[model samples]
Target: MLLLLSVCLIAQPATCRDEQIPVGGGAANAFVCLRNSQSVLAQWQDEHPEWHVEKWRCAANAAPPKKP
Candidate 1:
């Protein structure tokens, strides 16, 4: 029971892809959901000024981003 609880505590939270809005003739960019914590998306936009990032929310059945 203790091990199971520990596993649950350390488990990664479910998330969905937060894709950037594409401009005219431009490709959309995908971002990982950091459990919607740390304002990571905002940070990414700040770091990459060229990309147009859109605000996104996670749904109940959202799947986490695939690892590269």
Candidate 2:
């Protein structure tokens, strides 16, 4: 019966069938594929109060931020 026992041991059930790709501490890899809609793009003429500031928008109902 050693052959049967060996086969049983070798056929142990697997926990998952997904291909594991290590990303940010187990967090899945994701990216946003959206166009950057804006009014215009050009060089700023003068430095103003808000000139040094940067802005970012994630659609109002954007998904939660993924792990870093």
Candidate 3:
């Protein structure tokens, strides 16, 4: 029973979003989901020192923001 429960929990899919990240001075666009935004953003900043974040927003029906 314990093993079954663990498997079920692990199999559950995480909620995510199609987040838009501006690149190349707003002349281009990029996308990321909730599950990877943290690491993705970090890598983007490191690789593109000149790029800046214009704004970030969740795609339709994406994961809701966590409460404080």
Candidate 4:
């Protein structure tokens, strides 16, 4: 099973992905993010004890700057 977490990486407004591993086995992907990555992930962990974070990453939502 593969888990993917896409949490905002840079210091900008972006998306985060997280993969949760079930006790039985296998992984699931979830997209979540708030002002803080740690806090958000922590909350998710607390809510779902049956699953553990496998991997995570940030998906940038910022667009490239326009050339002058």
Best by lDDT: 4
| Model 1 per-residue lDDT at 23 | 21
Worst ten in a row by lDDT for model 2 = 1-10
Model 2 segments more than 4 A misplaced: 1-33, 38-50, 61-68
* Residue range 1-68, candidate 1, lDDT tens digits: 00000011113333223343212221122223323323544565576555443334422222343221
Evaluated with TM-score, which candidate comes out highest?
Answer: 4
Instruction: Indicate the residue-level lDDT of 38 in model 3.
Output: 55
> Lowest lDDT 10-mer window, candidate 3?
1-10
lDDT of 3 by residue, 1-68 (tens): 00000001113334222324422222222233444445556775576454443334333333343311
- Model 3 error, position 9 (Å): 43
Order candidates by TM-score, high to low: 4, 3, 1, 2
Lowest-sum lDDT 10-residue window in model 4: 21-30
What lDDT does the true structure give each of the candidates?
Answer: 0.30, 0.21, 0.34, 0.40
> TM-score of each candidate?
0.28, 0.16, 0.34, 0.39
**Residue 57 Cα positional deviation in candidate 2, in Å, after optimal superposition:** 1.6
